[model samples]
Target: MLLLQQSSWALYEPVPESYYVHQKNINSVTFEENTTTYLSGQWQYYPKQLLQTATPTRPSRTVLLPISFKEMGYPQNTYGTFIGHFKIPKEFIGRRIAIWIPNQYGAYRMYLNGDFLLRLGKVGKTIQTQQTENAPRFAYFIAESEYFTVTMQVSSFQSLHGGLENPMRIGVSQTVNRQFQQLMMSIAGVCGAVIGVGVFTILFAIFRGVRHSQSQGFFVFGIFIIFLALHNLFSAPYVYTVFTNIDWLWGTRLEYIFTYLSAFFFINYMFLLNQRYLHPAVFTIAVFVLSFNIVITFLSVPEVFEKLVFYSFLLGIIVVLNFAYGFYQTVNRHEPYSTINLWAVVLLCVTFLHDFLLSLNWIDSVNLSFASTSFYAFLIMVQQSKNYAYHSSRIEKLNNNLLCTRQIS
Candidate 1:
């Protein structure tokens, strides 16, 4: 039996005896009152077809909540029905009770007291609320006694990109936590890719005797690119193996580094496009701004630093736009290295805008995974641009030598 009591600010669920208690007090903050119940155990589950003709007289298998049926050796099929009976406690009378379902890959239909409560279809979290009156979906009756039998039936559909045997379970608290974790992981992966490619590119350039030259813009870009990747990794939960002592410091520093290096890379890229047209004054001002932001990030308090980062992101976007415009202008002028460079700049702008909008919660459907892939494509374009520029310069020199020989003859 599940008992729920609703308060003005919070909900309360009486702790069940069968609930598994993992950790009670580790860096814990005591709430005014605890308002959650662990509803996990052997739930009566079967294939969807088995439920239409007849309900099983005896349970074929008992599954756990907050877990996928596939985790229990069930086939990777969806649309199974879950039926469970719970007892309502007398203490929960006259309170608003709600169910929290974590998000799965696709859709879910839920019933309580034999009445449909809600239908949800998405890849994120969802919460369902219902009144105790009016013949609940599974079964919730006003009991004259201390306890009443409550029932719930849930049906979920398979995901579109079906590879995983286990889908994420749906419920409120778990869904919120899982989404947050996923966002961090996505950021980490992006950072790792940026760093990995940058390192290889830098080493390759140096091996080719392109040390500290204007052509080394690629290497400079690589340094900051990798720094940003490391930044993301440090900010996530999966940072146990490397740089363990100053995790928080690295995370904070990388936030500043991302903006500074991105600006620096843009400036250097412009220099590569045209050394004469590169505005030294503008580069100087950008450097000053970057340094100022880094200092602010380190000195401000944690909450204040977070706000500053958001503002800095806006500034960074403007700077990126400036670079994009420069690239466009160079390409329009038919500059020596325009073709591949312009493509790289265009791709970078698209991916940056896509990711920025997603981070701000402006677009719900944008996948960071796909966005990162686009960024990698942009990197490849930039590499091709470097190769074209090198080969073209060499050919021009050879043509000049031939002309000199003809004049001497």
Candidate 2:
């Protein structure tokens, strides 16, 4: 019986030893008696072209297995091949053997005892796992008592962008299954909710128009919802197709512009809901600043657009503070809808904080879509409060008119 274990150098400090035991022949042997031995250590690597002719020589350079090529200090321009030699015991004649590579980049070819066994390649730009099988006899025929050699030829194209530090890992495992079904499901659910909310908001806006003609805040809020919904939908695969044909640089610029515009609209709406109209000067200044954001978004370079977006974020915080103060003043005084508007303002502020943290990568678990949903819920509550205020005002006016008419009669 042999026991085998393998692990990465970064993760584990001490390598464990494996023990093999032999017992006298018995009538029957249980499956539990069998043990696995792991072939784990540094391997000699050479350029792919040199593998065919050059004699195998151990270089002083040593790299841990299941590692990335880039981290090994290989030339940035080329992919290298790795060769490892190990001995198998003569007693392990009829047992099945398997090799596992925890991670690999781009593509890889596997060979056993200098004989080609499998080739794996990704079908698209996305990371996908593919497998090729070899006959069991190939494994049996290749097993040797002295030393069995295994070689891997791995490549990472220079043109491939993103995640350059991703590593290649190899191990031997009896089972292999790597799929992220649950994560995909969660992403899908969030995307569906975002799209659904967007659709509903658009339909509500079309049918209801502005709830109050004099309240520019109501119109702004509706427009903000529309833009936000569209942004969320665009983040998913379904609508990505329409934008895929567009130039990448322009598409990115447009995305930032839309995000800033949505934030601006929301801020303006919150101010109106709190009945705290900004002074004409402040309002005009905000408009000018937002216009500048728009103009800069069209710049060919992204750095300028990023700076404008950051400025817009700061402006949004200022607007929120202004609205909060207005709600504080009005909630205690005259406005009938003030309390509800105040609550909505508070919720909106919280949503903003959550979203900001998410954007900064400070919070990992909470999705931005949840904050958007809460925003829409708050909008509905504020709209209902407005309706209640309208009806209360109308009843009061009628009551006063009746009392005066009775006195005159």
Best by TM-score: 2
The ten-residue window of minimal lDDT in model 2 covers 19-28
Candidate 1 weakest lDDT stretch, 10 residues: 130-139
TM-score computed on alpha carbons, candidate 2: 0.46
RMSD of each: 18.1, 13.1
Which residues of candidate 1, in runs, are more than 4 Å off? 1-196, 207-212, 235-253, 275-278, 365-370, 381-409
Could you tell me every candidate's TM-score relative to the true structure?
0.45, 0.46
Q: How accurate is candidate 1 locally (lDDT)?
A: 0.46
lDDT of 1 by residue, 1-409 (tens): 0122111112223333343133121111111112344334344565443232115464445555545544555543344555444443445445333343333323444444344445433211221221111111111222232221122333323222111112222123333333434554565565566666778767766876676574376576566566545544533232321324343334445644564566566566566556543456656666677777777766763345545556666756666666666666666877666455556556656766776664443564433424453365456646656777999999999999999999999
| lDDT string, candidate 2, 253-287, tens digits | 56566666766676566556543634445556677
Which runs in model 2 stand beyond 4 Å of their true positions? 1-218, 234-247, 274-279, 338-340, 357-370, 373-409
Please state the error at residue 60 of candidate 2 in Å.
15
lDDT for every model?
0.46, 0.47
